[model samples]
Target: MSWLRALKATARSGLTVERRRLEPLVAARAALGLALVVGATLALFGPGAAISSAFGAFQAAIATFQRSWRPRPTLALASGASLAVSTFLGYVTGAGTHPGPFLALLAVWTFLSGLAWAAGPTIGIIASSNVAMMLVTVTLPTSVAAAAGHAAMIAVGGVVQAALVVLLPVRRWGAQRDALADALAAEADYARRLRQDPVAPFDPVPLMTARSAAAVTPRQARSRPAELHGARGLAERIRPVLASLADPAVGAPAEGPQRDRVRELLAAAASVLDAAAHAIRHGEPVDLPPGAVAALRTPDTVAILDGPPRRAAVRLAALLDDVVETAEPRTETRTPTPTETRTQTPTAAGAQTRTQTASQSQSQPKSRARPTLLRLAPVVAARMRAELRPDSPVFRHAVRVTAVTTAGYVLGSALPLGHGYWAPMASVMVMRPDFSQTYSRSVARFGGTLVGVALATAVVEVADPGVYASASLAVACAFGMYLLMRTGYAVSQVCVAAYVVFLLGMGGSAWTQTVYERVVLTLLGGVLAMLAYAVYPAWETPRLRGRLADWLVTDGRYAASVVAHYANPAGHVCADVREALLDTRAARIAWQEALDRATHEPVRHRGLSRAAADDAGHALAQFGRVAMLMEAHLPERGAPPVPAAATLAEALRRSTERGGKAVRERRVPEWDELRETVANSGPLMTDPLLRKGAGLLLDALDDLSESLAPPTDRA
Candidate 1:
């Protein structure tokens, strides 16, 4: 990509407006904290303290809005505390006259803030906000005593926000409920789609979001509603089952009695799942469609579909029963068992299916137990330390940020501008670890600063508002920003820039700097951030092959794990399958993220061409789907073992691991051993579905090898 095209793409992204549902109540609540802090500080201390304290509340509110799994109040409190610390330390260093010590401290602090990206997106966002806030607030305090007083006021701001959040909550656990509900609703939609087109693609995004929401802190764990527990995993299980039942190659003939029965079951499952989703989302009584329920329970379904299709229907019905039984709203009490809640006759396999489903979905709280907020510190620390290596993008980003911020500070100070810190603040706010975000935010911030400064300056010239009026304008700007945070980054920046201008006006300073001065400094800072990335860049293109390799390794392990279960169901830990699935999902997400980031980078594919990448990705996706299908039809306890699968599973594990290494080494990946195992077990394979799925998986792998082959060899 050329610079012009990159700029165009990023600008378009930054300026694009999204139509998100505005949360007026939540916005008002956040704005009220800012209003309270500003009002109290103005009445008690003065405009300076009011301005200093408003930042704390504004930043705390922003932290609460970040994409984090931690409690919102906790996020607010932590953000407030970090801002206070940064402000106090900045005050301590700036008290000296030389400006050398402060610059050194600024560089070091900014570097650590950048390194915080290693922890995760949430921490990185909060840390950058803290850095930007510090740049503005540090210039507020004049002395050591003033620093203490201002810091205390900021802490008070945080306390006020958290208190308001706890006291007057807006739909408590709302995000979690929506996430889980969305996942179930998506599965219901997928079931309905399978009726029309059996090979319809199912998106994992909703299930991924649900899994993220289901990860609760220990404090949350104790108070979370019973219905939200393990339901995400159950939703995960439903997709493959629906697909297996629909696909003609696995479940039934293309057109016959079995196919018709399969369509009826699909429609019924959709109705039931939809009812369950609504009940869970709204805490309302379930209204299951009687016709759909009857279709699922009809004995003819069992008679028409035998083997895999029969098992899928029985399992689907059992899973649906558990979904409603778990998600059904009740008074604050422990949920009743299936037997306790309702009475029904067990089919030939429904009893075993229900028992197995309950043990897998209801018994387990989540896929894995996540640590509490207290335990998260060490985990985050470990992640940061792991990224300390030179090759890590987080490390490179830290270096770039440190250099850019310091350079901005020095250059801004060198010019005759009074508020030199504005340059570095703008840079810190806009920079990210990728080409797209860094450029997009830089463009957004600079453009917003221009419009904001001009608008605020115009207001000051025309109305000549007093201290109270200026503060009111600042608060209004903040309210607008909070309400529209989801619209776009550029939209939020306009409010932020205007808010800053009004805040400065509120301080009652005789304005020496004009609108152009502010715009120029901010533009310079943005330029510095973008230029620094050009000089010291971390390109995602080089990592594409490695990411693909990682995906292959994890996908291979998952297939082997599922295949191994068929060989010996009793010895298989269900948790292993769950773990392998999660690992593969994570790996796939990583690869896709890398690919997305690489699109904006101005570089060649390096080792993996675009065509090769697409082919390899498709192959791996098909490989994963095959495993999912196998997982859906796993054998019951005490069933006859498919001994042939053990040999195939071992071969798969060995060969795929080697294949991943070969890909990383820029060699064509081979599945010769896996093919040999399949050939050797020609007559021994008891499960024809397994044999057929294996053939499809191998065909995909062969396509991958051909795509990755040398150009000459391919011809």
Candidate 2:
């Protein structure tokens, strides 16, 4: 993509409004918290205290909206305490006569905040919001004692919000319910999609998201709802089963009675899933769809499906029963099985892999909401350290932000704006790790700043509002922003920008000067952010090939592991294949996310063209689909092993390792060794299903190689 095209696409995204279910209760709670903080602080310590402390309220409220599995009160309290430290530090540094210390502080603060992306988006948002708060808060206090008092009040605001959350809770455990229900709902939709496009590509993001939401803090573990656990693994298992049942190559011939019966079962499965999803989401009794349930259990369909399709129908019915049982509330949780108790790893796409119930997850506190912050410290530190490499996108983001802020501050000082720091503040506040977000945020901030400045100036000029009135107005804007959280980026920015304008007006920034300065400096900061990103962008385009290579490597391990298990069923453990399946899924997800990000970057697709990307993605999807299909029909525990599978498995591992290296070296990936091994093993293979699946795998890999080849070489 060119710069012009990228900007145009981004403009559409920035302004696009989504229609989603409004969380009026959560929004009202946030607004009420802000109002209480502002009113009490203004009454006791005047408007200055109100201005500084409301940031705590604001930050805490935004924290509540983050996609974290931690309790809302915990998030609120953490945001407040962190922002307090930042406020206190900013005030202490700004108290000095020299600007050098504060500038240095700003550099270090923004850099760390930028690097916080390594910990995940939730942590990054909280960290960057703190830095933005510090930049603004430092300018509020006049003396050291005043700064301490203000910082104390800021902490008070966070405490107030947390208390309100505990006292007047709204939809408690809503996030967990929504995440789990949504994952099931997504699978239901996928089942429906596969009825038509049997081999359709499915994104496992929702499953991944539900797994994240399943993490409960130790405090929550004792009291958490029973339904949140147990069924997630069922959702994971159902996806591949649905794909295998629908695929003509695996289940039934095209345009036959078996195929039509498969379609009916698929449709029925979707309906049943949607019903289960609704029950789980709302904590209600399972309202099984009568017709769909009848179809699933019907004697005719079960009698009609034979071989793999028949087995799939039977397995599907069994899984659905388990899903319904888990979705409903139980009198007492069932005892964890030995396998579930001993393992924390969720099974990948395999019929033999049993699920780890949500109730079982409590045993693994490391994956939970960081059971104790102290316990999670080392994990977070390790993640941050891992990103400290030159080519790491997270590290590059930190460097970009540090340089952008420093440049903005220098330019702000040379300019005559009264609020020189707002330039750097705006720059750092809008910057993100990727091209789309960084550009979209810059556009939103500038547009929002314009509307905010104009509106603030007009209102002050017309009404000449007093201190209390200005604070009240600022609180109102905060509420609007919180309410409009899901609407669009530009819309929220409009409220945030207006909120800041009103707060500054209350602090006695001259209306005319504040208006013009804010308008000009906001545009300047946005431009600076854009230019900095362009100069040192973390482009995702070149990384596409490497991501693909990773997927190929993991896929090879998975298929080889499965084949090897068949070769020596006595020697290999099911855990090996299960672990390999999980690796393959993770690699697949990384490649998909990287491809999505690369699509938005304004650069050439280095080592991969657009057509090749599409074909490569499809080929890889098919490769995994073949493995999933094979997994659906694994031999019994003590069945006679296929001797030829050993040679084919070894060849698969070696060929794919070579192919991955070829990808990294910018050459076409070939699976000739595996192809030859499969051809020779064809006559030796007794199982027709396994033989045909191997052939499908060969065709998929050969297509992948051709797609990855240079255009001239292909000709």
Candidate 3:
């Protein structure tokens, strides 16, 4: 009964459809790409050639949908090359005289391909496509020469799709625009929170998600997309400032006209950000609201809103300036700096300055050199080496994929079903790194296959699609699949199942028998995938402690950097601090994902209790809020109370190290020294804002300490 209930729930979730505003555009692109490939292939090579071309077109269309842009030519070529290799290999195995060697070859290929998941989603898709192609090849009856011809035709299809992508680019700035829009919307929400309850904890998810989405690739970083990159950078810089202004402890002036001005400034800033987001999304000139500019230039606005809000308002004005600059067309060049300028001076300092200037000019070209693969090879190698550890998630996932996929292949071969390849193919598609994702995908695959096969069967019986109609159906299904791929697994699966049915029908398979075989084999494959995990699951709970410790270490370093900046505001922002913040975000994201995975695992395998995990999560979030506040203070230029700031910095750093140790060693951290440091800080600390910020940090540390305490020790 429990199993039945679970199954019912899974099916219901799988069937739920999510509609996105961009679905129509996505559907249109998919349909057009598929239609072009199918129509061209049929005209040139007839129905038989259309089969191989269709597969190629399918691969290319999916690639476009994955990134929504034409990949760099080199990457596109590499992808096409991979597809060709896989198609050829599949063809060879299918044409071989003996079944034993083919089966052995397939097992090895599946195992090796499974490792591609470690690289990322794109590579993983390529690997899976290879396996799927092999399954298709085995079903076709053809000679070696015919197989080679088909492979060539398939490669051409991929090339055609790539060409289409290059010629018809869609939504070039879509991802970046969406990211900025989300950030703006989040700022509005944050402002509302400040108005309603300044003390309420801010959710960092939206800011982080948008920033991650807006992150540029190395290639893009080198290119001259200044406006997009500049806007993204400004958005990141503005986030911490916004967070600081929303701090409840820093209240508005009680009885001053400046208080109302400050409120007006906040509203104005929010409006400007919203307008900028709209402009970026719509590709129009940014038109600031009428009162927004006036609010920034108001006589007493800066003086009255002194402290974080004042600093934030000033920065917000600078950001608006940047947005206006970005909206304008660039048509002028700046004068180049002179390499050498002779100045009459009798002192040694003059000659030294000249020498330094000459050396800097000589080195400028070297510094501006573009990155090459040779230079990046060492970094990539080192990262791969680090992830090669047996304890690493990527390594473990790779091993799991190999073992399960091999088992799936063996099971499929042993089955008496006519189309046994479907079983292993289904398994290959469903297996993922985490338990929840794998289970959900498995359920979705099963339910979706049922729906797809049923729909395809009814269509075949009622319409009896001939060659042209089958091709048309294939194009339609391909479009639908790509459109819904990100929406939900089950919804996407429905399209996939329908597409396969049309494809097989074109190959002259009996419709009823084909649907039956696919349904049974799909169910068998899903069961195999689920059972593989059940037998030796990689539960996330056991790994939570390590993940938490990593976050503590990274975040602690970031806090230390922030403290250093506070002590010496004249110094430029430290690159290490920026990198540390990024690392902290990564670590936090990983921990959250692990916690989510643990939630879905059985009680026996969930190492931490739910209450304990929730408490830790809350503590971590508070820590993030404090870190953002400290970061917000980074741009302040006035001299700080050096001794006091340094003392607080040291205490905060030491607290982080202790917290990391406690999590790692399963012991309570000693917070006595930190508490003492915070409590004994002198009245010489003149900056009220700094004092308040330090108090916030101390409170966060205390909360974290309490959360980490053993259950027996907690009140």
- lDDT of the candidates, in the order given: 0.84, 0.80, 0.65
Q: All predictions: root-mean-square deviation over Cα?
A: 2.4, 5.0, 7.0
* TM-scores, one per candidate: 0.96, 0.92, 0.86
User: Best candidate, lDDT-wise?
Assistant: 1
Candidate 3 residue lDDT tens string, 48-68? 767777777677666655542
Residue-wise lDDT of candidate 1 within 440-546, one digit each (tens)? 89988888888777788888888888999989999999999999999988888888888988888889764346466678889999999999999989999999988
Cα lDDT, model 2, residue 411: 84
- Residues 1-715 of candidate 2: C-alpha lDDT, one tens digit per residue: 9999999887778767788778878888998999999988889888889888898898898998988888888889989998988878877776335578877887888888998899899989898889878877887888889988888888888888899999998878888888889999998999899888888778878888888888877888888887777677778768877888998888877778998998888888888789878988898777776677767656675457777787676667667766777787775654222222222222232224233222222232323454666677687888888899989999999999889887887787779877777788888888899998889888888887888778777888898878888888888888888888888878888888778888877777657767778778878888898998899989999988899999998998898887776766642226677678778888988888888878888999877988898899888888888988887667656778888888888888898889999998998877767878888998998777778888988888888998988788774
Between 1 and 3, whose lDDT is larger? 1
Error of 3 at 482 (Å): 2.3
The prediction achieving the highest TM-score against the true structure is: 1
Task: Between candidates 2 and 3, name the one with more favorable lDDT.
Answer: 2
For model 1, state the Cα shift of residue 47 in Å.
Answer: 0.6
Model 2 TM-score, 2 decimals:
0.92
Q: Give stretches of model 1 more than 4 Å off.
A: 332-346, 366-369, 510-514, 571-573
